[model samples]
Target chain A: MEFILENILNLIGFIVGLTIGILSYIGFKNTGSPTLFRLGIAFLSISVGFFVVWAGYMAEDFVLQKGHIEKWVQTLGIGIQTIGYFFIAFSHSIKSFFPKSRYLRSVGMLPLFLVSAVHIEHILRSVSFILLAYGAIETILSYFEGKKKGTIFVALGLSFLAFGEFLGWYSFVFPESILYYVSISIKIAGLISLFIPISKIPLTKIKFDSEF
Target chain B: MSKINAEARMVTTYRPHMKIIGDILSTTRDDLHSDGGASVTYLIRKANVSHTRISKILSNLVSQGLLEQVNSEGTFRYKISSNGREFLVAYQTFSRFAENFGLVI
Candidate 1:
């Protein structure tokens, strides 16, 4: 049951991410906006990341039959996702991930140093959480400035993704709990939320005054 | 806000380069004279841009084959080329898309 659920969530994530990536690419091609270009790469990276994890699950189910996924497979997937999150944050042009205050910066770095002796997967998950959280904050700041309805959805989506990654990191600590499934579900929800704003965009040709 | 205030706010808002290009192309295509062209003065008024800026933009558009310059009775005029129309369409679509993302272009 757990394996099937995991596969389903990852598949959904892959599909949603791929769709967003393609749409962003089309927008970039039309407008030559660097923001759209970055968004395209970001979603594509996220899609590929989900695909990697899903493939890993399939391989485990069919070829390995080990009843468990390899640590490296999950780590690789999360690492790729981290890259995507980085770009998402970068699209907003976040100058610094850490607060400017030296004390606050040290507090932020404390977690990574604390986990340095732990597994590589833990570190990667932490990094993913940090990136997604930063992106979410930036997006929310953008919403505050613009007050666009679409920005709200994006802000919510990024927040969900950040929270999901945070839970994913916790799932590593408690492997037997349901945190993993909840984390995956939230991430999928985040992707869908992000899609909402894009779907609302009209693809039809804009009517000009002269056309009337 | 009153309608006048709203219109004033809109006019004062910043427009990106792509948007200005779209406006120029649309004006040329739609506000043409009997000769199927618009003068620089007409474009300047409609596009709400400075004469010098519009001159540079028109030159660039002509060089890019998006606009055709014609000497109409000793007065220079510009017409939107086929490429310009296609570009305007694409620009309008993408502009709407970007606007949804809270982007200017």
Candidate 2:
């Protein structure tokens, strides 16, 4: 199980990187319009960032094996993860905060920075979990607001992520290595979140049209 | 209350090619215009529309007098009015513009 998990993360990281690459191409193809062009760049940024995390994680692991190299790798991992988070969050919607940009469609990178910091810093993990908890609750609320499908699934998924982060962080506090698996599980969600939808949209759309 | 409304909303995001819309609306109008009027069921069957969508379209047509409701005992009969004919013609013209521009419906 340990070997499998370790190897698969690397493979999935490549796949995720590929998906983002596809997204970038699609964005560019549609780039006659500014909106799509910006979106393409954002997706590319995120893909590049994820690749960094994949590389940083491996580097940090190697460093941990050496008595003298521990602190540097941890710092490097933290930096890469932080930058990756920035790109991920920036790729999502965040424009509502600015009045002018409210209509412009916001793409803020702030949460990426925040969560990346929280994850590596340990002290801020509680705060990160709290923010995610709030997000999970809001996702539930959105389900009640006329969203016809996937509302519950999304809510449950987000809850899982929140719990995973919270529990992993708790384990980190006590220096229990077992909880690292839980933390790894939380990150692995990108595999499900990123790839499953790309595969299932066709099936879901078919069922949707036939039944509804 | 209408399935068609739900379907319409579903497809609102689809952005179909103008040619497809023209094909669909032409077939629908052909089936509806034959007798100078159409029952909702006949239109639904011909247009491949569900009851809900028929009701939504009828409601709009009635509001604009493009369709008139012939109220009968226990059942309402829907008939295409002159206003509807005009709207159909206008929609056809719009389809032409869409095709020329390579735009989606």
Candidate 3:
């Protein structure tokens, strides 16, 4: 029963991320905004990562008994997702300063290197939390500067995601607690928050001329 | 942070020409409409650009049938054409999409 619930949650997260990814991609294509393109890449990575995690979970529950491949699949998913969050943070807070710096972008992969450690999952979760927290802080700072409604939602969504990941990491210390369920629930809420704004983008009214 | 990962680096910061053209047209149309018609000086202020840049963009807009030049009360002013109005609406929709990502279009 719990396995089914986890898979359902992962599916929902994947769908939400995919929706956001497509919206950002369309925006990037229309406006040619590098920021939007980065955001699109981030969300797409998240979607793909979640899909891999879902597959890994299914395999773990149904198939192989503790194989190296299955474990690495889960680790890679988390690593990719962490890279996505890192891009979100960089795009939001530091892109303008180092717009096309190859050097700066390399910092995003530091978490991937840590996957060789014994507690790879915990390390990935902690790194993801940090990246997400950075993004949330940047969004909040932007909200304060502009006082826009959209900014507020983005900030709240990213913050919730960070908090959820933190709780997931905490669950490692207290395996018998309900923190796992709570973490999944909160992460679902975070995905919803991120999904809501982009959901209506496709229906946006435009009066384009035949020439355009 | 010291050693850059070769595969993770962003190579370019290029924005498509169409986007730039849309930005110029939308800014011009919105500025003129809001002001009921505006002088070059007003456009420069509204677009946050230099006078020369505004002049070049306005000429391009006028040539593209997106703007009309008017001589009113001994002052040259610019106004949005019907085509420009439609373009503005399309640009606005694009802006809203970008806004979802907390990006300024």
Q: Which numbered prediction scores highest in DockQ against the true structure?
A: 1
Runs with alpha carbons beyond 4 Å of true place in candidate 2:
A1-7, A10-14, A17-21, A28-50, A57-120, A123-159, A201-212, B1-105
Kindly report which residue stretches of model 1 are placed more than 4 angstroms away from their true locations once superposed. A96-110, A144-147, A204-212, B1-16, B29-38, B41-54
| Candidate 1 residue pairs that clash | none
Over B1-92, each residue of candidate 1 has an lDDT whose tens digit, in order, gives 69999799787887777778989998988777676599888899999999999899999999999999999899998989987887788777
lDDT of 2 by residue, A34-89 (tens): 33343344345434544554554565557544423244443443344333333322
**Candidate 2 lDDT by residue in tens digits, B1-105:** 699988887767543332332333454456554444456666666655568756776676578675677765556666656545544554453332222112222
The DockQ-derived docking category for candidate 1 is acceptable
True contacts kept of 3: 0.35
Clashing pairs in 2: A85-A112, A90-A109, A95-A106, B2-B52, B4-B53, B66-B84
lDDT against the true structure, each candidate: 0.80, 0.47, 0.73
Q: Per DockQ, what order, best first?
A: 1, 3, 2
Please, what are the lDDT tens digits per residue for candidate 1 over residues A61-169? Answer: 9999998898799889878877887788787666765479989988978877887999987887777777778777777776776777887787788788889889988
Please tell me which model should have the higher DockQ, number 1 or number 3: 1
User: Per-prediction interface RMSD?
Assistant: 3.1, 14.4, 3.0
Report how far off residue A161 is in candidate 1 (Å): 1.5
**After superposition, candidate 3 runs with Cα above 4 Å error:** A60-69, A95-116, A200-202, A207-212, B1-27, B30-39, B56-87
Which pairs of residues clash in candidate 3, taking residues 3 or more apart in a chain or in different chains?
Answer: none
Best by TM-score: 1
lDDT of 3 by residue, A1-212 (tens): 54665677679878987877776676665445677788888988888888888988878867875532376887898888887887787776655533376776677566567565748778889979988988888778767756767777777888899999999899978985899888888888888888766666644465433333
Whole-model lDDT, model 1:
0.80
TM-score of 1: 0.80
